[model samples]
Target: MRLQGKTAIVTGAASGIGRATAVKFAREGAAVLTADLDDGATQDVVKEIETDGGTAYGIATDITVRANVDAMVAAAIGRFGKIDALVNNAGSRIIKSFLDHTEDDWRRMLDVNLTGHFLCCQAVLPHMLDAGVGRIINMASIAGNVGRPNRVGYVAAKGGLLAMTRALAADMAGKNITVNALAPGMIASPMNRGFKENDAFGENWNCENLARRWGEPEDVANVAAFLASDDAAFITGETVTVDGGSIAALVRQGE
Candidate 1:
């Protein structure tokens, strides 16, 4: 019961890492708020948590909208009493070269991936500050740390997210609030599966990843669970790489 009596809000909880984290939080004794654009899918996750004798609620929210984000934070507070943790997990990727990308494309990617987290954090931080303790985990990518081909917008947005995490951590250092980011490497999510089905992207991904295998959603959820727990009280302003050693290992000589 690492998170017993805590309330956690997980965005993009319709599927993949968000969904897994929502369930994990519930199982760890936190009352989970699963938010996503897909109402039906979110309800399914809520149902799953309830089936396991855990408490959860699902809300359909478009993170790109400031009003929606505000409403979401208010809903969590209204339902669960107070916000203890926030997992900014809603994001998307557009695989296109920088030269080929349009202004609209870049803005759209930033709106969802970067601006969404900003809005959510703004919406929840006041309450967290009032509570005197909180955890904020932003879902970034290793692509943000090192550039990847044909995903300029995603890389830029995630890089911004990483910087945001550090800045916020510094801003709230002694306020009992921790801000951190998770940089996952090639996790096998539905979005990545769609990209992998396309031969070109798949080949590029395989070549870049030294592990030669995709990471599971739980692989990330486990790390997230730890960060959300009190065990990571001393950890903040850091980006934890959950890439199965893909970024750490060196290239073989004759590969």
Candidate 2:
């Protein structure tokens, strides 16, 4: 009951980390708004929450579009009467070398991964400010912290997200709005399913991580729940790395 009576909106809630976070919020007594580009997929998540006796609603939202993002936020406010938390969980990745990436590919990746968070954050901030309390958790990646081959746009966008998170946190300090980024490393979400499918990719990913095993969606969800709760009130302008000690070892070795 950490989020009792709170209102939360989770983008990309149809699957993976987003879906897991939405369900986790609902279980903690929050009125969850689950949004995804796929309406049917979103509804399935809503149905699951309802079956578990939790309150949730589904909305088909294309986060890349400002109108869609605004409408999604509006719907959540309409349903719950206030916005308490916004999780910018929608993201995309295109595996291509910098030279191989086209203008369209770069734009698409930036739009969905970074710009989407911008639009959602802008849309939710007013309500959150009016309420004088809110949490904005932006999803980032370890790739943002370190260079990765074949993911130029993704790494760039996520790096920008981390910077934005810190900037917003500083700006919103006195407003009681905590803005932070969660940078997960090699989570076993649908977004990473392709790597799991390829033996070489999986092996490389495992070898890079100190845990030697992939992280689950729930692993990120657990951290999301903590960041969204009152316990994280004093924490802002920080990027919490939930990478199973991978980053620590990497930095240590590099030094």
lDDT of 1 by residue, 1-255 (tens): 899989999999999999999989998999999999999999999999999999999999999999999889989999999999999999989988889999999999999999999999999999999999999999999988998898899999999999999999999979999999999988888877876778767645644456666787988998898999999999999999988777787655356
Tens digits of per-residue lDDT for model 2, 1-255:
899989999999999999999999999999999999989999999999999999999999999998999899989989999989999998889998889999999999899989999999999999999999999999999888999899999999999999999999989979999999999988888888888888777545654566667888989998999999999999999999988877777533224
TM-score: which candidate is best? 2
Q: Candidate 2: where is the Cα deviation over 4 Å?
A: 202-208, 251-255
Off by over 4 Å in 1: 195-212, 252-255
Positional deviation of residue 58's Cα in model 2 after best superposition, in angstroms: 0.6
Q: List the lowest-lDDT window of 10 residues for candidate 2.
A: 246-255
How many clashes would you count in candidate 1?
0
Per-candidate TM-scores read 0.94, 0.95
